[model samples]
Target: MRALVLAGGAGTRLRPITSTSAKQLVPVANKPILFYGLEQIRDAGVTEVGIIVGDTAADIEAAVGDGSALGISVTYLRQEAPLGLAHAVLTAADFLGDEDFVMFLGDNLIEGGIGDLVASFERDRPAAQLLLKQVPDPERFGVAVLADDGTIERLVEKPADPPSDLALVGVYLFTSAIVDAARRISPSARGELEITDAIQQLLDDGQTVRASRVEGWWLDTGKKDELLDANRIVLGTVTQRIDGDVDQDSTVTGAVVVEAGAVVTGSVLRGPAVIGADARIVDSYVGPFTSIAEGCVVTRSEVEFSVLMQGCVLTDVPRIEASLLGREVRVSRGARRPAAHRLLLGDHSDVELAEGS
Candidate 1:
């Protein structure tokens, strides 16, 4: 079996950040999200993989190359536009050939690897297997309805009123039969060929479709809040090791990873945080769930639960949390603006003054 990783979405939800960098490349624990997906795929014993890329194809190609370093040979499939998930599969048809494949979304984070899922697919050889997880907002994701016997009866994409809380996770296992399903399905109401629609087509044709409730943590790192959450989840599992320079005057706590070339002096680094390579933190507090990317500088700044990209600098900033700082971002003290309230009064109305009223 091969793997087809979708790296094509525009990631509009990430806004200005996605405008410059691919969402899949966004870092959590100082590692790209796409890299984690690739690692998981490699761990599943898949040797050949195809990555479907869109506008950010060049960057993705440069990062993965031949995938030799990751123990896999990568073939790049270019999708001119993100027609939909099904469209991505259609684009990778040539690379996927007639073998069973696993499709993983680059922006999705799954705590447990897909190794077991791949093994199960190989054993059962189902036409398609969908991973399901209970989510609070089922309306925001593709949802599945289970029959009385616990089989997937139907799959719906972002239904306004969902039949179940079991939302479809981003990982999918499919056999060669899906190629025909992709060709047979029509575009959804949104004008894109959704993967859920194809699965619905399979269900309509009485094909075997299975669903598994995910048992571990899962996150879609498409927004600032989710990105921060993903960072905390992954960083919490990393072992504590201070490999870089930590000054004698500094105090380091649990699960802190100080990469080579980084210098921490007279500062306190809390647990489950990472200081990237060449980063400098001085006289500040690096709190929990923070990731300071390579070459960043934090001086006299107390930051917590924040992500600083390469070359960012923060001085005297305090209580920073759940922020996504782009490269070259510089945070410093600013002059206080005068506090005043302006009101547009009606022609015949009198505005009350604070002193009198």
Candidate 2:
């Protein structure tokens, strides 16, 4: 089966960062999230891939080129507008002609990979198979109701009251039957063709719909908090290694990965962290669950659980935590000044000034 990765969203939730970079390109453990999805697709034994791109098409193209580097041939499909998931599938119809394909949301992170799911689908040849996970907030996701035979009976997109806690995961396996379903779907009240509506049409028409409950971690990195959480989750699985220059004065604890060209001097870095290529850390404490991207600098500053993108500078800053800083940002010491609140007294009321001043 071929893989169709949806890379067209505007990522409004991750503003400022998404204003410049695509959400799928955001790095976790120094690797772009999109790359992770592509890697997963490659691992699933899919060699032909089609990436759906929108306004950020150029950037996505520059990053993922021919996909040959990852052992997959890629075709870039452009979407004119940010319509909906079903719209994306509709646009990719020509690329997916007559072949079953796996659809992956570019920003979603699935821990183990979808090799098993693809294998099962290949064996059974179901019309559509959805990955499901039990989430506490099913109202925020596409909810699915299953039949007694363990098949999907119905599905709804972000219902006010969910019928089940089984939320749809971002990975979906579909045959060419979905193309017809996509065409038959109408825009919902929200004025977009919802994918849940398309899937439900298939279920109502007596097409086979299957569900696979995922056992591994799945994260939708839509907002700042979820982005940081994805970073933490990925870093936790990293095994500590130093393939670059680490000075004698530097100490790295568990699960740290120092890429080539990165240098650390007189710094203590806790584990489950990554230092990207050409990054420099000196006289600082790099804490856990943090990813310092390529060409960044950390000097005499303490940072923990943060994602510092390329070319960031932090000097003489006491502490930084839980932040996703964009590229070329500088956080350093400000001009020295005396500490006090100064207020002007109007005529009759006189205020005593500090003794030193």
Q: Estimate, for each residue in 54-142, the C-alpha lDDT of model 1 and write its tens digit.
A: 99998888878899988999998999798999999899998889999999999999978999999988999888998999999999999
Question: Candidate 2, clashing residue pairs?
Answer: none
RMSD of each: 6.3, 6.8
Q: What are the per-residue Cα lDDT tens digits for candidate 2 across 253-337?
A: 8999999999999999998999999999999999999999999999999999999999999998788888888778787765557
Q: Go through the candidates in order and give each one's C-alpha lDDT.
A: 0.88, 0.91
Model 2, global lDDT: 0.91
Q: What is residue 176's positional error in candidate 1, in angstroms?
A: 1.3
**CA shift at 281, candidate 2, in angstroms?**
0.5
Q: Which candidate is the best by lDDT?
A: 2
Candidate 1: where are CA atoms >4 Å away? 335-357
Q: Evaluate candidate 1 by giving its C-alpha RMSD to the native, one decimal.
A: 6.3
